[model samples]
Target: MATKRFAPTPTPSLLSSFTTRPCCLNTSLRALLPATRPFSSTPTPQNWLTPKRGESSKSRKGKPHVATGGSVRGTTLVWGDYGLRLRSHDRRISAHQLKVADETIRKRLRGTKYRLYHRVNANIGVYTSGNDQRMGKGKGSFDYWACRVPVSRILFELKGDVHEQVVRDAMRLAGNKLPGLYEFVRKGDPPVMGITKVGLVGNSEEFLRRPRVPVEAPSLPHTAQRIPGTTPV
Candidate 1:
């Protein structure tokens, strides 16, 4: 008997056999892929942190040399008695710059009770005779006389430009906020009292000045005279 044999046809290529569903991917997985569009590599604004170079520390110093409590870069309040000890550096600071520093401090320390004080001393120049120069001597000098206020009264020292705006906005939203709080207003031609101690010490001309007013004054009796007793019908 003779047997018939049949040859099998060759199979299609593996690539041809495989199927794809439009290259679909999950939403989260799509996020992992690189952005197709060009991106701007700009950094976002940062709050509660010191400004970068070429940015003003509001004219006091390029950087705040003295930060008391917590790490200067952290969000938590650095709790401690912060102070500024100005050394004579031929440069003098401008009035505007002092305003900047005051505002900066108020903004950074908002919601936290911290005291601030300012003091001025004679800068004994590197090789000069007396340490008699006050801070804020130069129009743009880095050296300046300033102090931190007490933690309790810190909120009252806010400046008009930035700090006042913030307070005004807050008040508009909440209405008559921070009641009983007092603000220190700068006065006079240069808008600063010459050097005076936290209580009164250094030269006045070159030092940062605070407003002075009698905190407690007695009220006098009404000067108007009373009418004689009269009966009404």
Candidate 2:
């Protein structure tokens, strides 16, 4: 019966300052590490465009139709001097696309004295499920956030001491990142309701209220008209 005895290894100069006990080593390590501030579980506010907490996150994909009454809200610049207005059909724009467009404008107008305004909020949450999964249980988890923009609705506006050309160029670059056509609009411009612009002197209510007169079809000449149930000789 023989017993083997191993030599105790020498501790490095780094560990010479603290005892080799497991408890002492742990305490020593904690003391050597830098103190970290506790981070809040709540997410930092992204922007005003992001929906607030406790608000309804899931929203139905509603049509971007303007009511017949014609309210001119978001049709013209409210705070900014210049704006980018949608000129095409209504559609839902995702938050990512909007962010890219925003970045594009900001990048183009960097160092300029301009305050950009966002007319829309990405509060609507879109949900989707796996393509192979069978439908029936429930709507899948949220996929992305989006905002509905109707025809002639302003998306972004700029206000500040910036030049008109610079503002126009920035907006033009931004428009390329987003879907649908967009036009530059200025302050005091006529408000647009749907595809029609409400003139300064025109009443939106009256304009929408006007009835359409249907055009009558032109009558065909005798030589061109076909006889009913008659064979041509």
Top candidate, metric TM-score: 2
Task: Candidate 1: list runs displaced more than 4 Å.
Answer: 1-80, 120-233
Model 1: which ten-residue window has the lowest total lDDT? 187-196
Q: Residue-pair clashes per candidate, as listed?
A: 24, 0
Give candidate 2 regions above 4 Å deviation: 1-46, 54-57, 200-205, 211-233
Residue 120 error, candidate 2, Å: 0.5
| Shift of residue 90 alpha carbon in model 1, Å | 0.6
lDDT by residue (74-187, candidate 2, tens digit) is 788889899999988867899999999999999988888888888887877788889887879577788887888878888998999889998899899999999998899999
TM-scores of all candidate predictions against the true structure: 0.19, 0.67
Per-residue error (Å), model 2, residue 204: 7.7
How does candidate 2 score on lDDT? 0.82
Among all candidates shown, the one with the greatest lDDT: 2
List model 1 lDDT by residue over 72-140, tens digit each. 121111232222222222233333334455466556557754444332211211112235766655444
Note each model's CA RMSD in angstroms: 22.4, 11.5
